[model samples]
Target: MTIKIITPEYVVFEGQVDSILLPGKQGEFQIFKNHAAIVSALVNGQVKIYTDSVPEKYSKYFTKENEAKSAYSFAIRSGVLEFNNDKGIILAE
Candidate 1:
């Protein structure tokens, strides 16, 4: 599946990723392949993406500060999340 994180300045991160653990408005949640279409309010927190490959251009955006076994993550002040099919997009401010 694909995940794209965009801010008003630019596309923060864009690439094919294995998963996204988002900071939902109510609570945190994870999105994976074949996830049902859904939309959710996101709060200020980290967005963790798990993948073996991160495009060269976006590689700089994936931080290791919060890195896990095979995941890279970054934070957003606030945002909205949308997911469907095998794609997930985040509009972060």
Candidate 2:
């Protein structure tokens, strides 16, 4: 599924990802491809993105070592995540 993480200044991340793990207000939640439509509030924690099919050029920035084994994480204070029509959007504050 395509994922987009946006902050007030700029877009944090935008790409296709295999899975996403976030700290929700209720609890931690995982989002995968074709997930049901929903919106939830996020808490203070890390937002992990698993990129299985990222492009080579962009992968260099987000990936630490290798593409397959590497994942990207962002420290979020508070935010909202929305999933709909096979797309995931995160707006962080």
The numbered model that scores best in TM-score is: 1
Tens-digit lDDT track for model 1 on 7-82?
Answer: 9988988878878899987788998899999989899999888887677787777785444667888888999888
Residue 57 miss distance in model 1 (angstroms): 1.1
Residue 26 error, candidate 1, Å: 1.6
Error of 2 at 71 (Å): 1.7
Task: Evaluate residue 86 in candidate 1 and report its C-alpha lDDT on the 0 to 100 scale.
Answer: 90
Global lDDT of each model? 0.84, 0.81
Writing each residue's lDDT as its tens digit, candidate 2 over 1-93 gives: 899988898777888888898999888999988889999999998888887545554454343424447567678899999899989889997
Q: What's each prediction's TM-score?
A: 0.90, 0.82
User: What is the TM-score (0 to 1) of candidate 1?
Assistant: 0.90
